[model samples]
Target: MTTATTASDDVRLSAREAAERHLRALVGRDDAVLREDQWAAIEALAVDRRRALVVQRTGWGKSAVYFVATKLLREGGAGPTVIVSPLLALMRNQIAAAERAGIRAVTINSTNIDQWQPIHDQIHAGEVDVLLVSPERLNNPGFRDEVLPRLAATCGLLVVDEAHCISDWGHDFRPDYRRLRTLLAELPTGIPVLATTATANQRVTDDVAEQLGVHADGTSDAAVLVQRGTLDRESLRLGVVQLKTPEQRLAWLADHLAEQPGSGIVYCLTVAATQEVAGYLRDRGLEVAAYSGQTEADERHALEQALVEGRVKALVATSALGMGFDATLGFVINLGAPSSPVAYYQQVGRAGRGTDDATVVLLPQAEDRDIWAYFASLGFPREEQVRETLAALAESDRPLSTATLETRVELGRNRLESMLKVLDVDGAVQRVQGGWVSTGRPWTYDAERYARVAEAREREQQAMLGYLRTTECRMRYLREQLDDVGPDGRAADCGRCDNCGGVTLSSAVSDASVAEAGQRLSRPGVVLEPRRMWPTALGNLGLDLKGKIAAGAGPGRTVARLTDLGHGQALRQLFREDTPDGPVPPGLAQAVMDVMKDWSSQWSSRPDAIVVVESATRPTLVNDLAEGLSRVMQVPVVGTWAIRDPSVPPRAGASNSAQRVAAVRRRGGLDADVPPGATVLLVDDQVATGWTLTVAAVAIREAGAGAVLPLALATQG
Candidate 1:
């Protein structure tokens, strides 16, 4: 194939026929034929060998185009196609789909580490027709320096699935996806490239198309073919159910989940919520399972299989189950709304892929905004943090691991790592074997660009809220958010949606169901796991602490996590920044008493004394909690800690292990006199880092306490 290849008499007819054959084989239906748009994309990639961007709705045969193109290219004696997929779930589904077409596809991802070398060998030996890799793999040191160069030179076609992630303007922007620009630029001339996404607004579409045409040498390439299609999904019936409380929402789900058409997903905003919701639903006799990023790889696979086979009613999940999770889900219920419409569209798109009339419902609660804000806060850190990180790497003679870097900087591990990835893509840093090292290249923080992105995020959030309140066609509003107008470029209604069809989900949930939900949520206690080992590389921070912690506080219990469904909702109100610090509330105190009552049954020994940790914030709450526990347990409030350096307050969740430990140590010592070998109950209003409680427990133990049993009103874990 040459760069000038395009629609021609001989090439057009031959490519179209081959694409149809591949399409039919993949779909397992003799009647399967390429849509006009699908054929256009395949013609561009296979017949013309030109870069193309296909922006279509979910279930619009985007994958068919790429797979058929890969087949046609390989049949023409081209090299194996290389696809950069965003999620392992997507890669897994793609691999299976390619098999249906008799394409010898192989994948390299974070999972299946032991098979990497063999997979690479298969590609080299021409035994593989397609290679699917996560975008993160593209920038990996070994893969980037070795494997990528070879793949770029020899790959017949380059495909980017979920391509919207490459644009910062995209709802689910991923820093790693930006690395595709390098891959695109390095590919030999005349190699065809295809970028596909089901959820990109016009802004994201244009941004991706521009990037697709850019070469590595900061120059533009030939025009890229852009295939845009309608975003409406006929199978989806969109509706929003406004609920007042978490209990009400849970009650609605419990009452109506079984009424939905088929097995589907119940999307929650947090991992903790998924567990809580799934457990509640299971108790109500629903065959549901909780899934999140924390779920083990093997278990996630099993859960996914169960969902696919209709063995479970639904999976209460976070966005971990989003993006390319293929199932003919009959319905999708959101326990909470996504922060933006684009993300919301992508998620709900998972439903109704292979079935008609899939129910898409959104249950929006007041706390959804609060959840959105919490996630929004995790965006790009302040300029000072970037400077500190760069300085740390620049000053080091050798590569410093993230743990060591954490000692010098205060950002949390996840945030730190995310920043490093962005910096690496920007040429300010490079990931070496040890960890990360600063490149000598000059870099500047693009405050203006970041500000614009933030503003866009805010607008999207507001639009999501508007969607909930709009009386117009729900599908139309969502499509408009994605800049998807019909062929006429005019707004049109999807006649099947709840709004357009005048269909409403019954808002009435039985009071008994609500009460039961409240009861389940109200019964709160979460295991407070004790730290078994000191954080890695604590010595770098001048702390003597290292390795296993010596006989530290035993496992304890907390009333609830600040993110839990039941008492957690109430705790959030109590801990809001604007909320005045005061004595513990009646409900929280009752929950704490309940937890203590249940915990004492399993304790090896009963506590004889209670100790409260000093809290610069919520001191009154801590003292009150300690006093109440002391009164209930018939123990004395024997001791409390003092703040030695009030000027330097504890930075709760901002610090890493070393910084947290050091901060806690800087606080004044406990002043209690404990009888030798006496058990002590450690009390605190909340356990954020858990370091504060740990440091206090150590002090109590040194003061003659035999064992420390930590208890808190809530945990932030």
Candidate 2:
């Protein structure tokens, strides 16, 4: 057997032919052949051993190029390929495809802990051909410092899937993906590397291409970027509906989900939307399931399988199921428009892959930017916050867990973790065995760069808005947004979209279905699960509260989550920062009545008395709540939980459990005596951590109340 080592395309005709044969077997078809560009990538990676980035459209055979290349290289006695994929769904689909081609593939991810050792043993024995890992896996101290270095040096081909995430200026900015730079530097020279993504604007393409360069002391080696595919999915018919309200959107799905060709996806902008829309669909007799990052791993797998097998009408999901779910979906409808055109293009790409004539609809909403703003508000915190974090970690001799850091800083837990990851990439901090440790590296804070990224995001928002209102072809608009040019410099209208076809999509859903949807969403109340266990490491904050909260801190009811579909919008308006801290108006009081009435059956017993928590900012609201309950439930307003320090207001409901517990403990007390064995209803404007209600219940229990039920206007986490 003879092998050609040069990457010259003309020198590897035999190998490329064999690669096409393997591709046919992989796709399970008798007449499958590689497109010209697919063979080009394989030629570069397998024969030339040159670094490359392939910016092809979804379903453009990018994976086929890598798989065929891996097979050919391994046949020539090369080492295994290492692919860093972003999502578990993508990994599962890729593994199945690898098996069809008789390639031994295995994965290392957070979900499959039990199989990691066995998989590692197989790799050590040289029995595996390809390995898939998530970007977060690169941050695992054990794997990064130990296993990754070995894999980098020996792997025949390195693949970065969804490489758009590697760019900070991109819409989907994942801080962990930046960790790829370390692995890029670790790979030996001439070890072929492939970076592939479906959604990258010209700026992102240039940035990722530059980053993928095999730099040696601030220089680069030759690299090829194959970006030939036009971003048009010819099988799609795109349309947008500007709905007046969330209920109308849900009504549209309820009325027409079954009208979609087959099992598909109904994407929601938030978990709240997913839950609300999925529940409404189920009520209307659609076999729909909700999937989100918050869903348990086992349940998420079950939902994905259900959708794949066509057992459900649709999966109501967030971006959790977005990256690479391989079902050949027949349709995809968004509850609201995604903030970025590039992100929207990537998501809609999930449909129309293996089928003809798939429907893609965007229900652009008035509240879309409101939801986007909610996320942006939590983006990269101020420079002072970063400095405080570094100072906290640097001053400590031992590694500090995130819980410990929360005591020293006011940042939310999620935001704090995000900052840590970004700082880790910047070399100022590192995740170690116990937690995080400062590396003492002098890091310069680039405020200008962050501002530029933020401005880029705003531009993306505007572009997405343009997509909704554009009179041109929807496919052409998205393709141009991604900077994808065809064999001609610009692509033409496909004559398939609603605009090009001159057809107005029907928003004329049945009136009866719309009424039912409105009823479902308007009916309020989300069960407020009580805090069972106390937050860990409260002792670090000088509060020794630990273990489970007391029994009196039982399950309760809230009118709505501040992010819910029903009264949430109204309550949010009332809770707006500029809203006057006044008494609850009669209308909102009635809304509370509706929630309590619906929740009447869930409570074991009615309250014997009402207790209000003293709110320094909303005293009138608290007083009104107590008084209104006294008139409605015929229970006396017994007392208020007094604040020890009136100047220290309660933290937002989104605060970490540790800080909320500490704050509550610091200012906690029951001012009035309670009747022994009396049931109490604790009233407040909202519950975020549930600690406020839990601590109040404890004080009431100490005063001899037998039962406590927390009732609040809103709840959040």
Clashing pairs in 1: 644-668
Error of 2 at 284 (Å): 1.5
Give residue 557's lDDT in candidate 1 (0 to 100). 95
Residue 122 miss distance in model 1 (angstroms) = 1.0
Alpha-carbon error at 696 in model 2, in Å? 2.2
The digit string of per-residue lDDT tens for model 1 on 1-717 reads 126475668779988988888899999999988878888888888888889999998889888888999999999999999999887888889999999999999999999889999998899899999999998897788998899999999999999999999999998888888778888888788899999999999999999999998876787765689988988898999998888888899999999999999899999999999999998999999999999999998899999999999999999999999988898899999988899999999999999988977999999977788888888888888999899999999999999999998888888887888889889988999988878999989999999998999999999999999999998899999988998876676678888777887456888899999999999989979999998777777777677888887767899999999888788888999999999999998988888878877888998989988887878888888888887777776899887867778866667334588778877777567878777898998887788888877878877888888999998888888
Clashing pairs in 2: 7-47, 7-48
The reply for model 2, stretches above 4 Å from the true place, is 1-10, 214-216, 226-228, 485-491, 585-587, 652-654, 666-669
TM-score: model 1 vs. ground truth? 0.98
| Least accurate 10 contiguous residues by lDDT in model 2 | 1-10
lDDT of 2 by residue, 644-684 (tens): 87555667323567777777767767877688988898888
Alpha-carbon lDDT of model 1: 0.88
Q: Give the C-alpha miss distance for residue 679 in model 2, angstroms.
A: 1.6
Q: For candidate 2, what is the total of clashing residue pairs? A: 2
TM-score to true structure, per model? 0.98, 0.95
